[model samples]
Target: MTEETNGAAEPKAAAAPSQPVMQVLAQFVRDLSFENIVAQKGITNAAQPDVQVQVNLDAKKRSVENQYEVIMKLKVVSNIKDTQDPMFLMELEYGGIFHIQNVPDEQMHPFLLIECPRMLFPYVRRIVGDVTRDGGFPPLNLETIDFLALYRSELQRRAQAEAAAQTTPAS
Candidate 1:
């Protein structure tokens, strides 16, 4: 047997890359306001008010390196179902500073909008509850939100709006 007959090839070596990293640098309440619109009268009233809540999310890159800020804006309005009188109004803009590294650009948008906010929801919910209770009403414990579903729905809505805008004739 001769060595020339052997067919094995030499293997090449390269450095192992680091995995992706994501961290919550800090979480805080950017803004919060509670209004007892009807004052003492609303609490004394026997009628239970219907509560309406709306949440909006937004994110932006920070001036510092590898850092981004995500804001979860929440609005809550309560009014008597049968009557036009308002009970209370609460608004909160909760925010977080996140440090993201090694994530692909394509995935960054969803990660920031959905994942970041998802991580911060519990704290925001607690604050809302406390604020309502302190304002002399029953605590408004907000339910857990599905950020992924919300993001998808927003995308669909934007697509429909763009399509509608394109179809309408300009005067």
Candidate 2:
């Protein structure tokens, strides 16, 4: 590389684009409940039970700039596979405080609801397993969740509801 007679060498290349940043400021269980129906009713299990899980998510911006709180609510119900008798029920509200930066404004909603919960899933799973085992049943390991699909499904549900309302005749 050649330098000008009275000048220094060329300057360095432009820097790469900045990547988004996310940090978990804190994580905790906002609320938890477990009901052991089988134990309460004094029933014995003779076969494997059927289990179903449902999840809901919510996020809000905090008073502090760039900080947000995200909550994941989960409900698990287990019943006798054949008899359909209630076995146990569990509900947990887990939350995380996050500090996020560099994410585009248009993407913030998806980022908070999807990525934040994904980061907190491991802890939530551990809590569920422990609660089930301590409540007198084998530990239940949760299956991996698809946050992207969940987000899409929620959007579709809202759109359908809005369309239905628009089509409904005024009473």
Estimated TM-score per prediction? 0.86, 0.93
- How does each model score on lDDT? 0.90, 0.96
Which 10 consecutive residues of model 2 have the lowest summed lDDT? Answer: 2-11
- lDDT score for candidate 1 against the true structure: 0.90
For model 1, what is the alpha-carbon lDDT of residue 125?
88
The TM-score measured for candidate 1 stands at 0.86
57-133 in candidate 1: lDDT tens per residue?
A: 99999999989999999999999888868889899999999999987889899999999999999999899989998
What ranges in model 2 sit over 4 Å off?
1-5, 8-16
lDDT of 2 by residue, 70-140 (tens): 99999999999998999999999999999999999999999998999999999999999999999999999
Q: How far is candidate 1 from the true structure (C-alpha RMSD, Å)?
A: 3.6
True-vs-predicted CA distance for residue 119, candidate 2, Å: 0.4
What TM-score number comes out for model 2?
Answer: 0.93
Tell me the number of clashing residue pairs for each predicted model.
0, 0
The prediction achieving the highest lDDT against the true structure is 2
